[model samples]
Target: MQRKKPYLQPYWWRLLFRANGTAAWEAMGRGPLIPVPNAALTRAPLEVWADALLEEAPYELEDLHGDLLLECYAEPAVTDGTPPVYSRQVRLPGK
Candidate 1:
């Protein structure tokens, strides 16, 4: 009998936010990309990072499809030995 391969899901750009510096550092060490949600009142940390990264990135904003945009955020933490925090935000073309 032939076995079927599992369906692979497409990856979307996520906007993650860490309220505190420590959480941000932890997230960075784990992976370059984080998950986020889209909201009007508040912006997620991941959104800030994504925006900054995209600014330096060569990819055109128009390339990002409407379906791929994701925004996320987390509570900030307090602790020593925390790395410096950076913000990134990605705006779709014709915002």
Candidate 2:
């Protein structure tokens, strides 16, 4: 069976350098990041998409990998509603 050569998407080197610097190459000994175009990313919710990406990301720095992928889009901003507000754990006695 022929082994297919790894595909490093355009500008991935720059992104990886910015993300982990030379240390990444020294550690991993190989780079396998593939830039998924905006037209390719799924329309799933941000959190769900993030979880899936994190689970399957080939890069050691998942956060950076995810960010870099998102940055490829023209607009990486999230148009969802604000996150839920959580109240402090202080004692609120009203008995």
For all predicted structures, in order, the TM-scores are 0.21, 0.21
For residue 66, model 1's alpha carbon misses the true position, in angstroms, by 5.3
1-95: candidate 1 lDDT, tens digit per residue: 99986532222243333332233312322344443333411433443545655564335444433222232323234244543244343334422
Candidate 1 positional error at 41, Å: 33
Count of clashing pairs, candidate 2: 0
lDDT scores of the candidates, listed in order: 0.37, 0.30
Tens digit per residue, CA lDDT, model 2, 10-92: 22111222242323322122434333433323444333434454345444453442123221222223233522121111111
Worst 10-residue lDDT window, candidate 1? 20-29
Q: Model 2 Cα RMSD, Å?
A: 16.3
Model 2 residue runs over 4 Å out of place are: 1-19, 22-44, 59-95
Error of 1 at 21 (Å): 29
lDDT leader: 1
